[model samples]
Target: MEKLIKIISNRAVLIVLLILIQLGVLFAIVFRFQNYFVYFYTFYLLISSAVIIKIINSRSNPAYKIAWIIPIMLIPIFGTVIYLVFGRVRFSNKEKMKMAMVQERERMANESTVAKTTIDDGNPNAIIQSNYLSKHGEASLFEHTTSEYYPLGEEAFKAMIEDLEKAEKYIFMEYFIVHEGEMWDTILEIMVRKAKEGVDVRFIYDDFGCLFTLPHGYDKKLRDQGIKCCVFNQFIPVLSPIFNNRNHRKITVIDGKVAYTGGINLADEYINRIERFGHWKDNSIKVEGEAAWGFSLLFLSMWDFVNSTESNIEEFIPEYAPGELPENDGYYQPYVDSPFDRETVGMNVYLNLINRATEYVYFTTPYLVIDNLLMEALCNAAKGGVDVRIITPHIPDKWYVHAVTKSNYAQLIEAGVKIYEYTPGFIHSKTCVVDGLYATVGTVNLDYRSLFLHFECGVWMYKTNGVDAVLQDHMEIEKLSQQISLEQAKNVSFPKKVVRACLSVFAPLL
Candidate 1:
């Protein structure tokens, strides 16, 4: 009965009702109001035609142009409407300019003498030299910063808590998901205490990411505790189509001296206390130095976006004197990517590292959704004899996404690319280690959402000694992962194959 009622109230039902109303009006006009009916019909036709043309012309991605063109030509109105709503690229120029201004200021600050003097001479191997970083206006090296890698969630949590406790000046945190669990409670306690002590503690969490995890008015609760809180893109129950755009970046900067970022969110699942899938394995990086200030600025920008609060940049700069580097060793450049920009900097950076890799390319991501450009680049690298290995999860999070992930296996596997799935639990780390010379760790997943729709940030390290630690962690994960063979992919069930094919159509949405 409920379903029947729902059917009667659908758009199709509304359209039928509209048609009946038009017929009634026409009859009335023919008998008593002929002039009004003709004008109405003419106006409706003109508006409908204009909408149809607008929709047809909006079908844009170059890859899908041909496929959508025929449909658009056939069902000019309906097809065009769908295309206009879902197709083409859209960005706000105003937001882009705002972001550009912030980034430019950051660049100028990075080039200052004070920024140079802050480099730690003791650590000379901390810099990465890459065309992608240089082209994007990122620093070629980061000085006065040190980094620590946490391979497991428990370790990362402990380290993060310690860092928070040691924070003297301020604390800035941005996370996608913050659940009501022991993990968050512990952090919240510390945050409240820190705020009470007059520490400028601020936090930004994505509304959609925590919609189900947190209850209503959670942000208010945090603010009442003295912790400045901002919920990114507050989720509205209705008329909120943009909920898909999330602040997927996980960053925490303390006193502009230390920072943490990686795949781990503030949830029990990440720490293995309340496992949802299986043993959850993740990774995080803790950094201390001038580079950490960059992350602080990144968090501040997002915080201001949500809270409308302006921050003094000078206050956040670490106190250090300017001088020549004691050694030409450690330089660190950190940058972030936003969907508001036309450039897919994170994706392009990954591609650049893969292409320029001389020895090996090791990557870990939960999803394997690839666009054509990335697929070709990886395959070409494999064909060029660069060892390419990727680690994905064995315990599927979203089955359909996993199926889509498997569907692309054959092409890569045949090209001599090695793929593995962690057998014990889900591997949520989004990291890449190339040629043992450069590494990246952050929240940018290897999928359409992270590649194009969401805001992301990652630490790109080149010639950094930290690459060895990342490589070691990757090796440890490989030991626990099972490698997939072409034979296994070929034997996938027919029905499952069809499901994958259908899901692939909406891969962009995923």
Candidate 2:
């Protein structure tokens, strides 16, 4: 009976049924008024034309504009409806007002965050990148902040559990996916016990991301256990473009002393307890000092927005014994990318790292769907004597996306860039290491969804332990991966090549 209820009440089923019914009714209307068909068709065509024009004139991604234009011109009747429901990635004016207010309050409170920290001006590349994040991304740069990188998901999980158990004041966690398994059960038990012990515990999960993984009204269930929970952007059964933007960030902050972020979600597969597509490979990082404060504020801002309440920034500040933190390192900066901000913080960071590379740049991403600008920068860097390498999943979780990933391989290989597919299994880590001096790790992928339509975060380190660790990990992982050459990319069957070419046209929407 429970299984039957799930099948009947599935959100996907309901959405499809509703859409089909609406489409049927519209067809009936058009058939009944056949005499005015020309007028109706003309009106929709004009609307579609206007939308296409607006898209071309707007400052959005070129690929996104071209993708939308194809459908509008090919299927003029229903294209406008589809575009209205998914193409517009903007919030209403009222939401913009509220966001402005939130930014203002946070900005005033963060004026002192990086006032004392300085990036060495000797590296003009590092200086410009740090300033861009501070002024545009509203993130601070910190010096002497300790960082630890985990090459495996299970390693990060074990370290995170240890940190969570030590929470004395508060625990904040925000993730894109939270499945009920050994991994989540273990963390949930810790959170439940900590909440009962008076530790302020909070969890924020994206509703759309957990649509099938979690039970309905899961937030209320957590709230009943004394854990403050917020369902980020509740998913209702409808066709709306606002729902396209997702909270893809995975973050955890323990009393502002320790924080974790990466591509690892709260699921058994991430930890490799169970296999879905062979061995699951991923990475995560732990910041254990003043830099953790940055992730804490990042979570609080999203929490405040969802709950409509401003939290006291001072209340969650880190309090530690004199000798608690590890000795200082080099510069560390944590920043976020959001659709609301309309700035591609993650993409720009990757571009800056690639363009400024004097020695080499390495990347690991599950998806390799990127725009022309990033592709050009990487090719240029490789051509100009800078080594460029990217590692992607050999065993794909999504075949279509993997095809799109392969579609760009020949061009990259032609320009001297090297590509590798992880032979072990899926490499679900979003990370970049450059020149053994700069590194970043978090949830930002090279794909369009992560770059333009999701909320994401990462830590950028310069000349720190993290940089060395990340570079070493990349080099080690490369040994386990198989290099894809230009011959392999271009020797595909004709039908496969045609499919990939078609898929590439809509890669941005993937």
Task: Please list the residue runs of candidate 1 whose C-alpha ends up more than 4 Å from where it truly belongs after superposition.
Answer: 1-94, 112-131, 134-140, 320-329
Residues 415-463, candidate 2: write the lDDT tens digits: 9999999998999999999988899999999999999899899999998
lDDT of 2 at 140: 84
TM-score for each prediction? 0.83, 0.97
Candidate 1 is scored at a TM of 0.83
Clashes of each: 12, 0
Each model's lDDT comes to: 0.76, 0.88
State model 2's lDDT: 0.88
Give candidates' CA RMSD values in order: 7.0, 1.6
Q: Residue 229 in candidate 2 has what lDDT?
A: 98
lDDT of 1 by residue, 1-510 (tens): 999997676544544576466555644544453357677556545655665455456532333344444445565344443444344445466656666666665566556523343334343333223445644634334655567889988899999999999978899999999998899999999999999998999888997788667776788999999988888877653322364578899999988878899899999999999978898989899877667877876777676556545566777776645652123334556767776665677787788788778789999999998788888899899999999999999997898889889998988999989999999978999999987777899888888888877888888876565678899999999999999999986788889888888777667766
Global fold similarity of model 2 (TM-score): 0.97
